[model samples]
Target: MKKLFAMLLTVSLLMVSAGAASTQSSNWAQEAVWTAQEAGLVPETLNTSYDTAITRAEFCSLAASLYRIWEANGQLKDITPSSVSFTDCTDEDVLLCASIGVVNGVGDGRFAPDSPIQRQEAASMLHRLAALRTDYAGSTKNKMPHVFFDGENIRSWARSDVYWAYNSGVMTGTGDNAFDPTGQYTREQSIVTILRLYDASYAALPVPNTEAPYHAVLDYSGAGVSRMHLEDKDGNHLLTDFEDTDGYFYDITVFGDWVGLMWNDNANVALYQPATGKRIDGYIFDGIDEKNGVAWAWAYDDENALVVYADGTTGKKFIPKTVWSEGRAIVWANANTLAAIDKNGNTLWQYKTSFNQDTLVYGLGDRVVIEQDNTNTLLANGKLGTAQTYTIIPNKWSANYIGGDNGYYTLYDQNGKALTGSYANALDEVGQDIYCRWVSDTQYEYFHCAAGGNPTTLFTVTVTNGRPGVLPTDGAGVYALQTSQNTIACFDRFGTIIGTIQTPFTLDSLADITFENGCIRVTRMDIGADTSTQTMLYLPTGEPIA
Candidate 1:
């Protein structure tokens, strides 16, 4: 086996050297092309014609080969496509690229393999590759204040990708402050661009330990503030300085193998596959939500409904706002309609609801809960479940509990055990065992229970504001409550006050508080002046982020 490995390496090296030999390159591209050959990025047959326009097939070959090598380097999964066939092209390289998701067909399962590739098209392909190689997921267009003078020439679909490719320093524009987005991209240009992307991340980022879980943090390093300092589940360091930044503002979350980063200012969202070290950016959404291990980023759709997307990390596209993984065949719905699509986004089912404002649509795993006019209908995603009139917050089928109505609610565990026997005005889960329930309009009670143990009241507090809500914490089992109009109190499972977070302005009628683990955001709206004030802070401690 060792001898065979050596022989393969020697053959690969010889082919790389032969490709590097007599490679006639333009003066500007000579070194980059040679470097690409040395790194074995270009094909062995790509020994000449450096200035010739790269065909769709040739670029796909290059991208596909490069990505295979890139993914095999300490990659944690085997997501590479093996057998892909296009009607118009049988080129193995094109199939390989298609398999890896770098390129696609034109129409009717036909790949226009011989077509001359456009610069922006190359940007789109390489942008997809960058998500796999450079961890350069997310949008910089919103973060950067300027646009290319020829931005109007760029296609709307390629806009975010072009911005990402340009700003990440992987690809550059044509001169004269123009991108020349439609310009032809040459073989040499593709080689150089791939190498630049390769240099950005190849071997630089060690694959994260997949056996454990990780989360993101912002802390001061020796040079400056390290924005994405990821830590493991045990609070141990995992990776630091995850993405290159000019010290901008953003927050990141890890959902299983995926890490989602959202810019607080622009509402721009990016996702990272920590296992593969690839990123998906350019999603401008209000927020990301996860339930029962099914996570999705959401934004407003047309007619002011919710549009949910499967993170490109999953290689899935626009899915309906279904909550569970098995709900893939289910359609998305507003309060009025339910339209179902297959995994391929085909409309296989449709139902229009005549619901009013009081309707509640809840998802539990693959099953669905629909409550309208005090009548609840529970649907099994091919499974069996019971429903009631109460609003159920879906957890595992075991921990699912109904919501409060008329200022009182009940709680139940997954095993059908009643968690709260007493009447509770409101409730929120603070930890796996700890819960904070409102016993009255003004009094808030925090309690805990073992898996099979009884509920133990930890502490009771009468508040001045009594807003009936708990501030969200980084999933580390800490609960934050607005103790007063102007202050927030954070607690652990034991009802211990972690700290009191203060707001920048008065908590007016339209005040809103949102946060990640390391950051707390408070916004107060003044309709009288048509203005709003927002403040950012370190969580639990309430120290200003700046």
Candidate 2:
């Protein structure tokens, strides 16, 4: 990469110096000088000094050039230059920079353009250049903890921009985590900083649609500050800097083109269009299910009326504690009785349970699995049925199988008849036809049990990670498993390894993973520090999506 930069620099110098006379000898800033000249950022007619301190006018000229490049490349748009009336500097570059809010003059209509530029001031200008791009508009300028030993010396207004430059790898401290904010910046240092800023912005270009099948929303919070970002599958950030003011305890659910943000603390939910970063509407919701495209919550000032939002329509009925199914039904438990309601607020059926104990209801296709205190009961379409008592209520998947924590698994038919063979532990169901069962510490068995037919072992996998979980499918039957080694192994129902991806970080460093719309959103963190650093990645390719 350095060699490429050198070659580009040489070409740029040759093009810009075509009809101009060279004034300075080759120096340490030869490459940077060439780059500035080639991009039309610095005037070739001036006698450039590579070791002298950079002036405000020179820095503004460089900033204006970078901004123009971004605008020409389609990364920025609709930037109207400001008409600033500065007393000292009448240079077009300085006026352009000031107009775009990248630079500000001293008070009383005077811009000390000939004064030496400070490090913190330069950082602020570079940050403004970055903000011109739409993808970074949501980023917040939170105070960074322990980033620099001399952070207190930085000007109050420039602290956030300086921290942003430091964290984004565009700038570095002098030594021992000390940022000399008040020091005069040299011409060489100015060029290097500009190059770094240019590289960071260039890498943020949007990914083409054909290569990225999905986008991700990453939530990062630390040191009492939180933010959210949206990025594409190939790791280019689409939106950034969204502040999570309330907290980080929220759920991100995607339906069609919209992403729903459900905060746990409050009943209000926010629906956002990720493509545009616009909040469609905020609604009070207790729970939401994408399969039925419905949000359930108690109406304002009327806790008895259950407000439901589905298909862009709102309906209300007096129902409490509703459990939504994947199909077009909502089931609720009320006074020892379970009732099934359709989408139009019509009650389809109701069944009274034998035991009046407090029960938890879970929908399994057409069957309802109820955990009434210690007894687990399966009711078919709201019909009263027998209950089985277990130490722990078993987890049900695909409606045909229920796995318990007591080292016993059961597979039942549509009529509730138990099939033969005592499977030990069931991990999860793959698609609609296959169930993954744990055979030993490292081995898992995939059974082809369509409609609870005679179980047939389709394939067995010896995973490196003892614990494996199912990944979201890519519309096809192909699924993936994330192992303890932070590796994702993709396979079909037949257990064929179609592809494998090794994550950039370790499994223990992973904070969370959200699988949505055939894409996996992963959050990795460096937890043991004064300030935690959280990074987000888009997998199977393990690229930085945000």
Give Cα-based local distance difference scores for all models.
0.59, 0.58
Q: In order, what is each prediction's RMSD in angstroms?
A: 21.5, 24.0
Q: State TM-scores per candidate.
A: 0.35, 0.41
Q: Whose TM-score is greatest here?
A: 2
- In model 1, which runs have C-alpha deviations exceeding 4 angstroms? 1-23, 76-83, 133-146, 201-546
lDDT of 1 by residue, 1-546 (tens): 545544554465467655465346777876566667767788977657778888999888788767767777843244656567888899887887787777878888889888998888988998777666444445432122124544535554565567567766677777634678789998888888888877775211212213437667776434432345566678876434454443233556666666666544544566666566676665333334332134544432321212244343342444344543322434444555565543344455456556533455656434456676665554443332454555666532223454555657666543334666646556775554566677667687867664454778866766556544443654433555565667876555444555678776677557666654224567776766557556555445444455
* lDDT score, candidate 2, position 456: 73
Q: Which residue pairs show backbone clashes in model 2?
A: 82-99, 138-241, 139-241
Error of 1 at 95 (Å): 0.5
Which regions of candidate 2 deviate over 4 angstroms? Answer: 1-216, 219-226, 229-292, 295-311, 317-322, 328-330, 333-337, 342-348, 354-366, 371-374, 391-397, 403-405, 414-416, 425-427, 475-546
The 10-residue segment with the lowest total lDDT in model 1: 202-211
Q: Give the deviation of candidate 1 from the true structure as CA RMSD.
A: 21.5
